[model samples]
Target: MSSRPLEPKDPGLSFGGGARAVLPLTIAVAGFGISYGVLARSAGFPPLAAVVMSATTFAGSAQFASASILEGGGAVASAVTAAVLLNARYGPIGVTVAPVIEGGFWRRFLIAQLVVDESWAIAHRGDGRFDLRRLIGAGLVLYAAWTSSTAVGALGGEFLGDPNVLGLDAAFPALFLALLWPQLRNARAIAAALLGAGIASTLIPVAPPGVPIVAASVACLVGLRR
Candidate 1:
């Protein structure tokens, strides 16, 4: 009797299916990246900074916030504060997906860096059978797509001189709306969102850059658990 799973490793395996599944996610991520690039470039950030962020953080919202703070001539403390607030969601993602990662600490850390929302959705779709190769492959595709798109958009912004008339400002928000739409599938999520929003709106005036997000996240968690 073999204890192994039904599928075994094969060097000849193709990522066509995974690629297809990830295409929409990649395109969506790319769009956000492009938006970020445009905004950052227009804000007077050198192209290299935009590329560095997309390559390093690979997080759309965090990168956007960081760029905004920096572009506003805010100090390093402000930039880090914004980034930390934006990236707090990753801790939850790591907690939820820890069971699926069967690797050492280094591998886990690497994978965690790639555990953005879309990547997590794609990874979890594998039904507890996806190997590391698949996960890594998906992450790489997303990373490349995101970074390269940022570069392209940065260059485009440089050429265009401004994003106002081009309507690039709305791109990231539109993407966020689309990303968030799927999560509102259930009554629990809907309720949580409403509850969180109500609370956060009340707190927004008093809260710092990230307190609202944290407060809302906590409210949603409590709502979901209850």
Candidate 2:
């Protein structure tokens, strides 16, 4: 008997599956969002402005860095510079995922807005190809979680007291480590990580907040040379 040909997966099903796969990570993202909301409020942002920043920026690290800089009396230019540096990783991420994104100009442009580290990682199927449905789905879920959590945190910031007192300050770093740990399976990755860490740690005291992260991230070039 002849076997039937395989059918393409339904986009909705793929989207749902992707969302489910990323749900666990989204929990951590929510926690980070809440922390960011608290931090933003403490940094002198109005609750609405804090929520708006999270909605528009959708970058926890950059948002946090900018808020911290602003809180420390840094100029707006300095905060913007830090945010730009911290978000530079998205350039590579966008390039890597660009070919797999299916759409017209506007569609691609909208999708590009969702290309954060978490969605990028989840969209990569480990075969140099991306699952677009998963990418979009995961992005939607994460975006909603992040933005809503930010709103909740910002509104409740008054009652949350010190975010540090509740240890929320550790959530973002912990989530990032959890994400990075899975990708360090090779010597090159390990070496790059160590180099980046060393560089950032050494520069932390002297360089501006996000500058060290950007400088250390250059270690990723080591992988390209291999």
Candidate 3:
């Protein structure tokens, strides 16, 4: 027998399977994007500004934070600060996902640009058998959903009444709870969330708009380490 080691085999899924994956992702993203758009509009932002944010920033939480800062007469520095803090989670995400990406510089760059929490979660859920095609498909579909929603929101924002009156602001928390509920199978996770919430409540009165989120995230990290 030759001395060469055996190479692992890959299950190359069919195109139909890939489409099945992309469809649900697209629908979810589009719905989230719509909510984001309505919120941006209700916050008194121009439609163009929202679209630009969806295009450049690409992170929903960061974009919303930046928009709030901007609309509140905050300076550009404040917007950047809020966005950076809110989006700090993406850095860790990138670290873990770096190996999954395989491509030339430009392709990798595009993929990185599309690496939000949703895409990362979807990619990881693919059972370690994904390829460039799947990643690209998921990313592009999400991007399209986000951008399309922003556009729709922007268009509607101009002619529409206030979105906040309809409790649009609470959408984020609801989304978070929806995501968190499924992950609460363990005691540690629940404890961490409660600790983080306590920290946030204590800090909210004294801290700035985006600072409580940072503090809570830190608290969660520390709680996890304990």
Candidate 4:
């Protein structure tokens, strides 16, 4: 007797599965978003501007760095430069995910906007394959969580008083560490991370706010040869 062929997975189900897969991460993302909103509000951004920035940029590190720079009375050029540097990692991410994205220019453009580290990581399957539906689903959920949390934080900033007093200031860095910790299973990755941390620590006092991060990113190149 001949066996029936396996049915392809439904796109909607796949998308929902992806969203559920990353649901835990969404909590951390919300915490980070709230921290960013508080920082932006403390940095003198109006409530509307802070929420708008989160909605439009949707880049946590870049937004944080820019807000910090601006708060310190840094030049607009410096703030822009810091944001660019922080976001430079997306260049390779966009390249890696490009083939999986299908559609017209506008659709592709929208997809590109969602290519953050978390979504990209969730979308990448082993063996050089990607799940496009997962990418879009995770991105949509993260974007919504981030923007909504930002609005919550911004609107409630005055009532929250100092985020540090509430211990919310540590949320972003702790979340980042949690994300990075899982990837440090190999010796090379550990080495790169330690090297980056050392470089960033050394530069923190001498360099501008984002320069150390940009410089520390060079340690990632060590993995290219492996």
Candidate 5:
């Protein structure tokens, strides 16, 4: 009898699958990153500093809120507060995927850093669990796109001159609607989305920058009743 050597395990999960699934969204994310870079640069952030923020912070809405506040002559403390409030949603998002992310402390921390909205949405298997492989794959590539595009916009943003002029500002709303479109199949979901949007629009005129968003998120509580 001949003994065969051990074969490497192939879990059959392709990290590339997640990367590919998110590829289309990656383009939109890049556009959004470029818009942010332009805004950050216009807000007086150096190109390097803007890129670093995108690389490290990796939270598009929060970064935009912070930069918008700064551009409006708001104080650093106010900007920080707005950013923090905008990112509070991540606390819940992180908890949802904490169990599937198996690793030691440092490994877990590193993986957790990759749990942005795009990766999180794409990686969820929709069965009350997540695909760790998909999460890591989608995250790494998205991170690269975000940081590099930020550099492009920050460095060359001067020539672009007002992201809105070129319709770059549309990237954000477009990206979000794309993401939201997939999840709006059910009536409950559709209602929740409409309610959230209505809440946000109503508050936008009267509330502070981040308050409208946070307030609109209360519509998610509607999901709990079912």
Candidate 6:
């Protein structure tokens, strides 16, 4: 009798692998959280309010966009709109990993909270597979770092003064680059990445805050043709 083929082990998921994988970026995450706190404070968010936002929202770009609009005297509706638009990318991201997440409605709902850019990328196991354990682990650590740092920045906003002076703005970009570097493995991957970058660059000047990122991601559809 022929034996069944052995199953491949999940690359990561056990023993807090996901959490450890994302730890190196803790500093960057903290910097970004702090930057957001400062911006939120500058936008008139009270210290408790900013920390609560970080804890609850857990979305970096969306928070920043909303805070910026509020700072610019935009109405609450406008600020909420900006935030929703910036976070729209997660709709696609959520679908991508839906299959790997184990459990029913409530469990899944809670798990979904951890699916941020950093955790998603860190937990990705290539060929469209993701490790839920790693994702959860990374998300938990990142959440702690973000919420705590936001508290620090919010309370110390007066002393921190200008976030730009501390060069905190570079944190997210640098973290993105680090996450993206490992994915540029082949000609097709490189081409897709370059195309996405080109599209984003073209749209940045002409489009709204979140438009370029969402627009550029359309380039990834090129793979569907293959």
**Model 2 agreement with the true structure over 1-226: per-residue lDDT tens digits:** 0011112454433778668767877767777788788888889999999989988889888999999999998999989988988888687678778897876999999988887777766666543457787788889998999999899888884565454565666755665566466556778878888999999999989976666766886787776874
Regions of candidate 1 where Cα sits further than 4 Å from its true position: 1-18, 42-44, 125-137, 159-210, 219-226
Cα distance off (Å), candidate 6, residue 201: 1.3
**Model 5, span 189-216: residue lDDT tens:** 7888999999999988887765776687
* Candidate with more favorable, higher TM-score: 5 or 6: 6
| Best candidate (score: TM-score) | 6
lDDT (10s digit) by residue, model 6, range 90-164 = 888899889988789999999999899989877776556777887899999999999998998888845655555
Clash counts for the predictions, in order: 0, 0, 0, 0, 0, 0
Relative to the unseen true structure, what is the C-alpha lDDT of residue 81 in candidate 1, on a scale of 0 to 100? 85
Per-residue lDDT of 145-189 in model 3, one digit per residue for the tens?
889888887777345545556665565455455545555566676
Q: In angstroms, how far off is 155's CA in candidate 3?
A: 1.4
Candidate 4: residue 148 Cα off by (Å): 0.4
Q: Model 3 lDDT vs. the true structure?
A: 0.64
**Cα shift from native, residue 200, model 6 (Å):** 1.3
Error of 1 at 116 (Å): 1.0
Give the CA lDDT, 0 to 100, for residue 121 in model 2.
64
- In model 5, which regions exceed 4 Å deviation? 1-13, 161-226
How much lDDT does candidate 6 score?
A: 0.80
Better of 4 and 6 by TM-score: 6
- Sort the predicted structures by lDDT, highest score first: 6, 5, 2, 4, 1, 3
The models' CA-based lDDT, in order, is 0.67, 0.77, 0.64, 0.75, 0.78, 0.80
TM-score of 1: 0.67
lDDT by residue (1-226, candidate 1, tens digit) is 1112224544312244344445656656676678789888966778888899888888887888877887788888988887888787677657767876777989888877776665555444322234444455667788889899899988884453444355555654554455455566667767777887787788889876556756776654655374
